[model samples]
Target: MSEKRIIVTGASSGIGEAVARQAVARGWQVLAVARRAERLEALAAEIGCETFAADLTQEDAVAALAEAAATFRPTGLVQVAGGAKGAAPLGETTIEDWRWMFESNVIATKRVIDALLPLLRRSTAAPQQDGSASYAEIMVVTSIAATVSYQGGSGYNAAKSAEKQLIDVLRLELFGEPIRVMEVAPGMVWTEEFSLVRFGGDQAKADAVYKDVQDPLSADDVARVMTDILALPGHVSVDETIIKPVAQTHPWMVHKGPLVAKG
Candidate 1:
């Protein structure tokens, strides 16, 4: 079978990094995109995959990323470059925080998709080794907050909800095209940076968020689901997958145990 290439955004760390590594391990070429040049270089050194350092939220950087990706002609794209900002109540949330959330999550996803459409279309025309239909896949990693609202989560929830809606509309618009749009909403993922960044680098607060959880999902756990969905036949499209650790029922519901900090 011919090699399959994929572009993974937010590949500097967490779920995006895991997806890039896992894809490379599965014999697929990966173009890792992130804002941290040092981190991307480290990942490329470790995994031997191409790396592009660019902030997707910037128009010029995203355009450059798309141009590089077009040359690679990746058959798949995984948009994982998004996060939550200040966890303030509706009235307390600053306009800047809300705008940042929307820009990072919704606007960035749309920009990357728009810039890569030509490459994605070209991928669709390539012949499949198995003689099956050729399909280019686009996966977005949204959060469970997209559907469920919680206290002090209005800004994040709104942003993620918009991203989800965008994916839904894209799927419907590209129904007959050889492109598959999928969304993965993960809950309670225990990544080192996610909570830390959300809490403004307050280690204590970040640690408290998952202190009592029996077993929280790791970045790789979420990436595994993405890889599995991508591995499916081109004719099969897993439209939306909501994945959570067994201890998590929803965004607000979680099974808490004794608080224990790992050294």
Candidate 2:
């Protein structure tokens, strides 16, 4: 039997890295994609998987990712190769900010999936022996901010919501063929890449973003949930998942658990 092929995007850090690492450990052949060559190389070395250095924001990059996928002929894909938006008041928003958010979230995802359509189909057509399931999974990592309104998130919410809608519709379109579409929505995860990228290297601002929320869910938490969803018995599919910290009531509300003030 051929080893299971899994493709993970945004695999350089955060939830993507965690999922890629975990999947590789489960005897799955992982194709990790991200723009940071050094990071991807280090991860590929540790996990003994293939790595591709491509910025998902570029259409060509997505095409390259698809070409790489064709070689592996993967049965699983985790679309975690997108970026989050920074905190900025609506009135103070820049045009570039809006463009970057859409490019990274919506366009990038569309491009990569479009390129890998054939691979996904192959997985659905293949058969597994010994009662093991050989199904294809296309999972997207979205944010709770897309569903709930929050200040300073107009552009970001719109982009994520668009992708979420696309996935929801595609889910229905892909039914009855063994191909599954799912989305994992997370709330207030504190990861080094996420915080640094969203805050644009402003450590102070990023630190404050999570200071009020006690015990915010880490990237590992989300990864565990994702892996569990994949490990379920045959014919059991998790369509949608929402994960958040206990203290976070919603997108805008944070319960500020006890903590010493930072000077």
Candidate 3:
């Protein structure tokens, strides 16, 4: 639907899915990428968008993810596919699980950007003062966990923090260029799939995650904000925006008094 081309990683669910849906609504041509082909296909169909199925954890897939942007000549990039492998208590956490979190989230993201940079660069070569766009921009969904962590999130937190730093370096390096990079961190949004993905299909436990917070941010809420950020004029580049639901305050705090009591 968009006149401009865009690529969204982790397009299967969560913030990535939300961003893609929002982009399509604004008439942007969307390339939804994710490990889950079924979900991506359904999303693509529903939004009249394109899709690519790749685990992104595999080296070959990461390579494909980066280069895939070249084929589409996307003007936008959204990296949202990421997860915490296991939530074992700190001492019980294994290197293997930690690696899973880092590789899938950090390493894969780097590889894809490495491959896609050339294309993104091409799109933004000449800063667009003209109506036609010559450069592209990217939006990456990070977690509040990157800055702080839950008791069992030692590994996941580190991985996101590392990713965030990498992008910070990229921004400094790309200051003169039109290829913009941004990060959005959401504290807690009701992605429906969030707990399912986090707890790995434990319906009861997943449901309990939000039992206290009555006004969780719906996926639509995040999608709307992200869409607004992207729709901003190109002259302005948003480095990162951190957001959290009112029910959830900070990493170490929770304000679940009561919805009726909440202002």
Candidate 4:
């Protein structure tokens, strides 16, 4: 039996999927959660981790997920099932898009955390001889957009920023507990669906986001960081980390083409 059990959201694709794969490789009992049953099933068959399908934004779905997860007694929660719906300026963005953004990014995160926190607490591992206990963890995958604002990114920026703030406060609220709250804010990840979905399925526009950029961050790159952090002793908490490609200094400050030495 695996020593640790972790709940990874967004396991249907992208970063969450990558994290689940790596966690399983490290001998973790992973409850891979996502909305798509097929993808989660495929992952489970290939990697031998369990899967749960749920749309976290729905109250009934989250309640159901929490009840199911309680059976496994998860020691960790990884919130990564979030996205950007549109790339319009604040005035041009529709209220529908804004609502979706908040619901998917911020509200979904809150719902999952609220419902599953008790399970995490109950599953805390025994303290080791090194004076460190294997504490429960809550790791969120925020974005660099959470901290940096750009034109036409108002909705995503606000929603992600709010999500980051929620994680920040959660760390404070759980100060005396053995629960560790953390977040990884990545910049310019070249995921297959992120930009495409943000641009509303415009392939060309999504392609343009990474056009000529040399080696943008990949899902595996971010996942490596997340898993490595989780592997650390429970006494050590990374708290917060921001990851980005060298070509991406900020949302608007991406440098296309190769990086050459300046004379």
lDDT, candidate 4, 1-263, per-residue tens = 22678999999999999999999999999999999999999999999999999999999999999998988789899999999988876888999889999999999999999999988888765664564565889999999899999999999999999999999999999989988899999999999999999989999999999999999999999999999999986657898999999998998999999999899
Q: Of models 2 and 4, which has the larger lDDT?
A: 4
lDDT of 1 by residue, 1-263 (tens): 44678999999999999999999999899999999999999999999999999999999999899889978888889999999988877998899888989999999999999998789888878678877668888999999999999998999999999999999999999978999899999999999899898888999989998987988999999999999899887668999999998878878888798435669
Model 3, residue pairs in steric clash: 1-27, 1-28, 2-27, 2-28, 123-134, 123-135, 124-134, 124-135
lDDT of 2 by residue, 1-263 (tens): 43567788889999999998888877888899988999999998898989888998887777877887788888878899777666788888778878888898888888888888678888766468754656778889988977987888887888889888878988888878777788999998989867777777888888888886779999889998998886664356788999998888798988786745669
The lDDT of each candidate is 0.91, 0.83, 0.79, 0.92
Prediction 2 global C-alpha lDDT: 0.83
Ranking by TM-score: 4, 1, 2, 3
Model 3 misplacement above 4 A: 126-133, 260-263
User: Which TM-score value belongs to model 1?
Assistant: 0.96
Clashing pairs in 4: none
Q: Estimate the lDDT of model 4.
A: 0.92
Q: Say which candidate scores most in lDDT.
A: 4
lDDT of 3 by residue, 91-197 (tens): 88889878888888788778777777777777765545555556578778878988887887788789889989878888888888877789888887777676776
Range of the 10 consecutive residues with the lowest summed lDDT in candidate 3? 126-135
- Pairs that collide in candidate 2 are 10-81
Q: Which ten residues in a row have the lowest lDDT in candidate 4?
A: 125-134
- By descending lDDT, how would the candidates be arranged? 4, 1, 2, 3
